[model samples]
Target: MWWQAAGILLGAVLGAEVLGRAAGWGALGAGSREGHRVAVTFDDGPSERTPALLAVLARHAVKATFFVTAPASERYPALLRALGVAGHQVEAHGRWHRHALLLSPWREWAQVRWHPRAGGAGPHLYRPPYGGHSPLTRLFARLNRRQIALWDVEGRDWTAEQATTLAARTLERTEPGSVILLHDGPGVTPALLDALLTGLRDRGLEAVTLNDLPTRRITFWAGLWRLASSYGA
Candidate 1:
């Protein structure tokens, strides 16, 4: 009896922690178990290398979701605007792309609002920087009806050796709805982006935005938006 109780306690703690770190109560980070679809999201973005990435995506004629910080979008409104015009989804990563879980709801709202002004906004999605959030995160997410997304696969494209090895590995490991992660940040220079873009295409997989994954239904977080809207009326 004691062991069973302990096990339950441990499970609950870990569950909350997972939700805390990933920005929502996401049991699976970025893949769909049902239809074998995948969504690719770009974080900390709209950087200098971002355009190169966008070009590669354009060449392939693929759309992707870019979760950028308020500052980044603010600085690069064109990048934000262009993404929208190109039929891509733009979401809120954070204000400075910082750990926003600790922020109050008002602060959180301010950060989210910043992105539209900085870059642009269509569907509002939030991904906490570095994948950690505070208790306040869930409350704000609920009130705002924002879906929080996290990645399941980390290609570790931040390091030199890791980038090359992980990029290939990511493709090999990907399933239909898997959210595979790659950094187009400083470490992943133009060459890396080209290789990754080509790699994804060659593997018989198409690059898609977070919303583009062939999902019949979005997650509970996303579903809440419609739920609340209907209730309010």
Candidate 2:
């Protein structure tokens, strides 16, 4: 019985890992539809390219969300301020781009430090790097009372892919209530953002911030356990 229990536990862990990698690890979404409700979220930024990204969004009159790292927030406090001032939602995206699976329990929590907000201080949304989560992530969420966010649509814009390709991929994957994952860091281009915004409008989707996305709160423990069990079974 003991051996059987151990095997089940191991299977659960492996299953959870696979599901996380494949499905953005239980990230929140507004669900699939043909409605005009999509959240545009950018990660790994406050870089030199961020201002341009902001400008593109502003030009389109789109309010998006930014998931910035602590070091980037520290280095570019003004950019973070600008993001907030522009009426964009700013949230946490860990301290670096390393995988959460490799972090220690303390380091995991520490990595998700908050950037000061214009409304106040601290973060309300947490998007793990690479959208990967672990048991420590759930524990951090439970302790800190933060919401874990995952994306339903992604463009892989951080790679060497062209702006047109990025735009096309995002448009291809997006559904109503999709949480579109993009990057405002080095590799992202103004053309990519512009094209994406235009593409979204063409598809009858409105770009919104996380706050604007329809969300229902779930108890952290229950949600975490449920996600694990579903994948395990």
Candidate 3:
């Protein structure tokens, strides 16, 4: 039984690694830094809240990565430009936050690959809507050469009826390499960024931009998304 359990664990790890390489679903590994380093990632955004969040980040002198939807970015293209100027990393979060669990890898690749908002090529990273995961999804990401990043901490900002309480608790529980999840959708305003940014500062954590780290050069899948850098477009 113990051997079986070990085998499963090993398989999952190896499988994820192989799938990540094969599908381009991995990220820069050296990102884990000294001190309590952590990453803040927002999803489904470039919304009205995005501007507010940008201001807060600027004031606090911090940066956070945004995994934005194509349409939302298209709707607020200027905000996308601001995010870039602020030195934040822009990543792909699918065309919209729709479900595609049963989607084939190729279709998933094309959906994100061709998004005009994404500036043509898919990003090196992708976080599925609602944390959705599957082998096909992984495969597609690998084929596109993107990473399927899962989070370590989530503020549940979408359920922000009482965001303050949740945000505070999240800070108290975070550790190094923690990926904090936020939202920039309709109800998820940039107003919520204050608490999160404050929490990070109080704890003496440095927020990082993807550009701060060297790009993971998995040449086996490098050129898959040539335009992943069309972040501001």
Candidate 4:
């Protein structure tokens, strides 16, 4: 009897993973690789460090997308306004930073439903925290009319001890159509962004917002690879 119950539980877990992967196919992780365009996106911010990050982006004349948490948006309405004023695309990163997989069904629904009051009109996008998705994550996105935005490249700036090294490594990984993932809350991000922008310029890659990036739905295997590589599957 115990073995039968264990088999059922295992089957359920595998079933969820399969469905989640299928649902994630519609998500945009990278744009077409034919052009020299990339999108630079920042997550979890509007923090005190965001002003400096904004300055760096401004200096480079690059417009990036910021996937901001609802709590941060509420705490720093001015920063949210500033993001819009600066021509950056602001989207929802969720109600909180917790991964969707860790939340209950109701909480996950609320997470996708919660958008900043300062967010603009239609065509909203949502990026789950840690790029983690539950079985129903895509269903919630559909109900809320939000497109799930995932990244193809990660800067991993949060783990870096120095901005220069992080920027160099990130630049090495970035290519055409890369949706680069960086964070706005980290102290090193400002400098890292500066160096990254400069490197992108040197490599002849233009950094643009997701709207400008000529995106396409991620291929099934590509999306699976991205999830596995970035979030350890």
- lDDT top scorer: 4
TM-score of each predicted structure versus truth = 0.72, 0.81, 0.70, 0.89
Q: Arrange candidates by TM-score, highest first: which order?
A: 4, 2, 1, 3
lDDT of 2: 0.74
Candidate 4 off by > 4 Å: 1-24, 117-120, 224-233
Per-residue error for 63 in candidate 2, Å, reads: 0.7
| Candidate 3 lDDT score relative to the true structure | 0.64
Q: For candidate 2, lDDT tens digit of each residue in 1-233?
A: 99999998677666555554444344464444556788888888888888899889989999998998888888998998899899898888887778877887788877654534524654477778886766566667757766777765677776898889889988987778778888887555678889988998988888888788764343354355436644664
Q: List the residue pairs that clash in candidate 4.
A: none
What's the C-alpha lDDT at position 167 in model 1?
65
**155-218, model 4: which lDDT tens digit per residue?**
9988946999999999988989999999988888998999999999999999999999956788
Collision pairs in model 1: 36-176, 36-177, 37-176, 37-177, 38-176, 38-177, 73-118, 74-118
Give the Cα error of residue 61 in candidate 4, in Å. 0.6
3 against 4, candidate with superior TM-score: 4
* Stretches of model 1 off by over 4 angstroms after superposition: 1-16, 22-37, 101-109, 112-123, 187-189, 214-233
Clashes (backbone N, CA, C under 3 Å), per candidate, total 8, 1, 9, 0
Residue 193 lDDT, candidate 3, scale 0-100: 68
Q: Model 1, 1-233: lDDT tens per residue?
A: 99999998677555544545532344225555555456666777777778777777788777777777767777887877887788877777777665654566577666544545334444456777776565466556656666666665566677766445656776776766667665546656445556666787676667677766743333577434323533463
In TM-score terms, candidate 3 sits at 0.70
Once model 2 is optimally superposed onto the true structure by TM-score, how far is the C-alpha of residue 221 displaced, in angstroms?
18
